[model samples]
Target: MKVAIVHDELVRRGGAEQVVLDMHKAYPEADIFTLCYNKDKTYEEFKKARIFTSWFQYLGKSEKLIKILYFPFAILAMRMFNLKGYDVVLISTTHCGKFVRVDKNASVITYCHTPFRLAWRPFSYAIVNSSNMIIRNIFLFASRVLRVFDSMAAKASDFYLTNSKEVKARIEDSYHPEQPVSIINPAAKLDNFYISNEVKDYHLVVSRLEDYKMVDLVVKAFNQTPEKKLVIVGTGSMEAELKALAGDNITFLKAQSAAQLAKLYANCKALIFPQHEDYGITPLEAAASGRPVIAFGKGGVTETMVPYNGDSARCTSVFFEEQTVESLSAAIEKAEMLQFSPGFIRNHANLFSASNFIAKLKTFVSRIYNLKTDTDFYMSLTEKVVYARKEVA
Candidate 1:
């Protein structure tokens, strides 16, 4: 069957982009469709695919400018896509990519990372950090209009999939999806990561330095504790501002390749995740390296990390109750005190392998399209579910 993949944009790399890459791997022949495509800014692997871009790609040369123009142009640009002949259109989006018009015969399978945050939550970081009152007002007005467009787009999909139950619940409450949302947590590249016997004193934070991510709070937490070291691996608009806020002990590295990141993950004392994400892939990567996490105790991180609940041996993470510097610092201190089993943590991570994710995704597509199943893969998954239930009983 002919397949096409649609994504919001390809301006920068993130968990959403990784999902698109994974989908491309599953459907190697699938052509990619998007609002914008930046060959320099995104993954190099995308160069292998036949990428179709909307007019938004010509709007700007800089990623910053592209992002600024995105919201206004996204819906219209996605609607302009001519995805007529494909048998399956797999939409991977947080925003307007779902607005793409497809043939009635084709099945639209949407993997919603999250509903558009700005559209649903107007007083969010985007509005507050706009700086210009006129721009903020324009954005606020646009959000109200986009919310309606977003809902209409949601209705176009034949099936829904998401990264976490957190996002699954959000999709149901926000879009009121016709079909039940399937949770397929994004996987870690287990082949690239491994545990190290010699761990260093430093902690790690691997995220885009965005306002909503709360990286500044982490910098503050580490600033107060000069004895602790932090290695931040990412670049964004806030890079300069975050560097100014960070102390001498904090080391900032531009985003590394997966192999380099594996080394960082294995050697770090723990990974610090401050954002309330849909489902964080970094924490899982850290777990794959057998390192524990120090995280804000909310959002999807809670679902992934095995938090300390009187048993240090069983936990793979330490959660801070609040987003404050004091709370996060305390969690960091608590994490240092805890003794966790590296082998056990790696075992937990093995359940969310890339192969497993692809298996589930293939099964979903097969079932949806009424195609023949891979009997061995299907039976293995069924047996595991049944065994899990038996364990609970």
Candidate 2:
């Protein structure tokens, strides 16, 4: 069957974009469609696929310009997709890819990373960190407009799948989808990450330098403790702002390949996940490398990481309840004291391996394709009978 994979954009590499790459692995022949494409910014593996970009790609290649226009342009660009011949259109999206149009006979299955957080939870996003009241108010108004479109897109999709319970709840609250939202947690490629013989002194942070990600919080926390070292590996819109806030204790690295990142994870004392993610992949990656995580105890991290509760042997991470410098710093101190088993940590991460993810996704697609085939058969049979009756009369 002809298949198509859709993603919101290809400008950056994050958890959502990684999901798109995994989707491609599941359906190698499926053509990839996106709002825009930037070969330099995203994963290099996408070069193997037949990629089609919307009109937005023609506008500009600037990351800031894309970020500014993404919400408004994405909705319109999604509708402009001509996926008429594809039997299945699988969307891996956090935002507007769900609005993609296809023939009535085609099945549109959305693997929603989360509801549009910017639109649905504007107060918790970049605007919350902004000092300008005028910009905040305009953003709030724009959120309302985006929400209307987001809800419409949610209702149009035939099936819904998500990466975590946290995101499923958000999707339900935001769109109130009639169908059950299946939860398929994303995976960490255990093969790509390996345990190192020597654990380094520095803590690691692997995430996009975005406002919602709260990378700045980690930088500020590390700054307060100058003795402790931090190595942040990733870049985004907030790179400059974050760097300005960081102290000499904090070092920034551009995003790395899987092999390079694995080496970083294997050597680090522990991964620092400051953001409240939908379904965090970096924590799993850290775990796969036999490294523990010191993360804010909320969102998908709570589900993925085995938090320390007077049991260092069983725990793969130390959790801090509040998203504050003090809480994270305390957690970091606690993690330093704990003696965790590398074998146990790696075993825990094995539960969310790339093989498991690929198998589950392949099964999901097969089931959906079978149901669509049955529906088409019944529809064609009904149409044939109706024509016979018309001729008889």
Candidate 3:
């Protein structure tokens, strides 16, 4: 079957882009489409795929500019592309994933990370830190318009998929309550685990230094620890701020190769995920390296992090509630108290392996599409109910 995967911008690889990559692996024959494709700086692995781009790709050189330019480009490109030829239209979205207008006969399924924060989380750090006032204001003023378009896009879909149960609830509460929504948490490519042969003394944190990412909180929490050192990976605008705030213990790293990161993850005493993530791929990496994750108790962590119950179900990680120095300090202290068997971490991490995600996705697709089955009657009934041919394509 010919499938088409769409996203807003393919500038830098983060969690959202990984979803596209996995979708590509799932549907090798599918065409990968996006408003902008920053090919020159794209991850080497995606170089071979049939990446189709819109005119805005020329503006993809700078991600700061690309984020501002992608909205209209993505929305306008719906009129520019003929998506009717594809059998499955899977939209891996965070922002403009639901912007496209599909043919009435095409089956569109959107895996929404969340609605654009400008609409849902206007006060969140990710939205308030916009570079341009004009564009941000224009987007804010036209938020209703954007919401209508997003809703229409969702309404036009045959089904909806969410990365977490939290996200699923939000979709039901905010948009597409009538649509069939399913939960498919994002999977991790566990092979990328960076387990240094020789252990490092410092703790490691790999995240964009955004206010929402709460690297500031991590810094504050670690500042009080005094004993453990910190090595922060990834750079952002707040680098200078974080650097100045750091004491003798915290170290800032611009970036590192996958192998280097894996080594760091393996060697660190534990990975500190201060921020509440949507569906964190980093914690999985740390656990894959036989390390524990100390994170804030919010967002998707509740679903993924298994708290220690007993010998049979030991937690891969622990969570802290108050995003303050004291709370994280307590969690870190608790991490020291527990003994994590390397085998237990690897076993839990296996559940979210990329290969497992592919198998599960294929099964879901078969089940949703009502592909030939032994229970012909039930299959026929769902085929009629799910394939809203006249409603969405």
Clashes of 2: 0
Model 3, poorest ten-residue lDDT window? 384-393
- Each prediction's TM-score versus the true structure: 0.89, 0.88, 0.88
CA displacement after TM-score superposition, residue 214 of candidate 2 (Å): 3.1
Candidate 3 segments exceeding 4 Å error:
125-139, 194-198, 309-313, 371-393
* Candidate 2 residue pairs in backbone clash: none
**Candidate 2 lDDT over residue span 3-65, tens digit each:** 999998888767777788888888899999998889988878888889999998888655677
lDDT for residue 24 in candidate 2, whole number 0-100: 86
Give all candidates' CA lDDT scores: 0.84, 0.83, 0.74
Residue 370 lDDT in candidate 2: 82
* lDDT (C-alpha) at residue 346 in model 1: 91
For candidate 2, the TM-score is: 0.88
Error at 253, model 3, angstroms: 0.9
The residue pairs found clashing in candidate 1 are none
Higher lDDT: candidate 1 or 3? 1
